[model samples]
Target: MSMQTPKQLGGISFGLMDPETYRDMSATKVITADTYDDDGYPIDMGLMDPRLGVIDPGLECKTCGQHSGSCNGHFGHIELAAPVIHVGFTKLIRRLLRSTCRECGRLALTEYEREEFRERLQRAKDLGEDPNDVLKSAVRQARKASNCPHCGEQQADIKHEKPTTYYEVQDVLSGEYSEQIAAAMQPDEDDPDDEGTSPSELASQSGIPLDRINEIVAGEFRPRTEDRKALESALDIDLTEEDMNKLMASDIRDWFEDIPDDDLGVLGIDGEISRPEWMVMTVLPVPPVTAVRRSPSITAA
Candidate 1:
């Protein structure tokens, strides 16, 4: 067999792997979590599956049929127990979540606004200025929009929790009223006869029945205690259990790819680039076998 000289590379490309990409690259489905056995041998069907080629000289590599240093490492994959956000794209996730609407999953900008901003960005580019400056301005404006221009639903504030979690800042005002709240904002001053005017008399003055005003003053607006308890209990579903439901990597890839070009452009990403949501790591790439294998050190005799 004749060997061909390697062509000189012009540039290297890096990208997120969709599920199909992951499947195509993987040599085996790693069913066992173990990497090596007690004797340091690669465990069968484990993370260091032999189908992923071999690192030890004693065993023949399954894929390349080479021993030890002669074989290049092949990739094998283990299905994740749960989805995790990709650490690399934390900032991108925050930026995308904040700029897009939760309800409609669309950018907060109106069609007209996006067009205008697009023009501004292009003009800036033409003028030999940084288009990113214009993009940032548009993003700033979009972030302030509270409602989705497409859906008309209110947009909740997107918050980034520590260690790669995204949360919506839904400030649900408690409907329950406590006596402490009433006492904090006392409505009445000194009335000579502590028992203020009868509901009828107050009603006469305001044209609204004094009884109604009394109900308002006495905090009738507060939800009854039993009702509040029921509500609290009803909303107490376990979030951890909900998170256990696995989302397929392919579906997630589609979601990232589905974000409109204009929306991604506003976030300073061109259509050719992956969306910020791709930061959520669906597939993990394994290093080359040669990279992981420890090379023997030569010592001077």
Candidate 2:
């Protein structure tokens, strides 16, 4: 056979793989954490499923039908019970969340500003120059808008707690209520009839689970007027129109999905190879056993 060598090397681009692409390339789905069976054979649908590739010398690869030494191996995938944020991309995700409208998923900028940014990004790309500075400027401007220019919905400040947790600062008690609540919460030893609200009660009300908040936001759960009144009376404070809510991986993914392809360039993303939603992982790829296992000689050493 004759071989041809290339004179010039083209550039390489890296991108995240979406779930569809992951499943398409996978040889099997790994369900169990267990690797082998009681009889010392690889288990089907398990982490060490033979379909993922052969690590043992005598065994043939189920996917490629080749012996261990000759088989290059294949990939397997695991479907996560819930979507999870990729730790590496948490900062980028936070930037995207702050710069885009939560409801309309468009850049939180005026029409003129959006057009201006798109042009700058496209010009930079055409010159083969880095567009990071332009992207940062757009994010900075978008973050300043209190309401979405496209949808007119109020935008809340998104705060990231260490690692992966994100919280939306929806609303706060007004100055008047803050002062009243502070006074009401104080205990007066001289007046035995005075009862101060416990801290635990306040914590419970404020720390509503993200899932329940999602339901409430979707109009799936509605509190009766009486219940609302009762809660206000018990707390000795009026609840704000919107309560602070946590953002889950799924919620973040949904927000990203609403972003249009045309806007991705301004967000420092290439829409052709990567979508923003893919940053939150729904499926994980597992390398073949041969690629991970240590040889007997290396293990002994």
Candidate 3:
């Protein structure tokens, strides 16, 4: 028998699974958070669904029809109600947001700058060199642009708060407007008969739910006239507020989708293998129970 020499490793690539791919690999859709029912049986479509592989010794996996010890287990998925930013990619998302045009979703750099960076990226790729430095420089240059070269729209400063929040900062209200607004909102102590609108009434009129108030305050939601009016009427204030719009995962995903494939290399992303939008999770993959379950010996120990 002849022995074959091992082949040399060329490179390694990591990619995120898009929603469709996640769904395709999932054994079942995990609809309920419950693991077991009242009878102690695994609930269908729950976290411990038999289709996701059984943890119990006697039970067989519903999907693979193998006993607990033999079954490698299958994956389950949960469809999120709303898109959310992946915590791991918060920095990358922020960098992408800052480096791209808010209006056109193109790189904020001029044509010459873009071409230059692209050339640098291509050279790095050809040489099998790390392109992170080139990407960082390109992103740094792009962030300096106040207006998008492609669409000529004024760009706002992209701010990333720790964990997962992102905000677009733009000046909307001047100092004079702020003072006038404050004065209008202040109650007139001299007028004994005046009863101002209450905070509850204003909140109700704003059409924003209580749960979303934090997001609204953090600039995740765009300001609407009704929302502004509610605060103004409640305080009896006339004011122009600064634009601190929150960028939600869905919004970011849309922006990423608009980015040209050719430009992805400059951003240090391989468009063919992965996409920026995939960084924002719409579907969550759940491991089978057996994979996560502790062995009886370990538990006893």
Leading candidate by TM-score? 2
TM-score for every candidate vs. truth?
0.69, 0.74, 0.72
Once fitted onto the true fold, the runs of candidate 1 whose alpha carbons sit more than 4 angstroms away are 1-10, 37-41, 123-131, 176-258, 271-273, 295-301
Cα lDDT of model 2 by residue, 93-141, tens digit: 9999999999999989887998899899889999999988899999999
Candidate lDDT scores, in order, read 0.62, 0.79, 0.78
Candidate 2 matches the true fold with a TM-score of: 0.74
TM-score of 1: 0.69
lDDT of 1 by residue, 1-301 (tens): 8799989999986765565566688887777666677766677777666777776658788888888777777887666665567777767666776677755567789889988887887788789988877867776787898788898977666666665666656534343333333342333477544543444544454455445545644767543334334323433311111112223434333446557766777666765645555566555666554666442221111
Candidates ranked, most accurate by lDDT first: 2, 3, 1
Displacement of residue 86 (Cα, Å) in model 1 is 1.1
Decreasing TM-score order of the candidates: 2, 3, 1
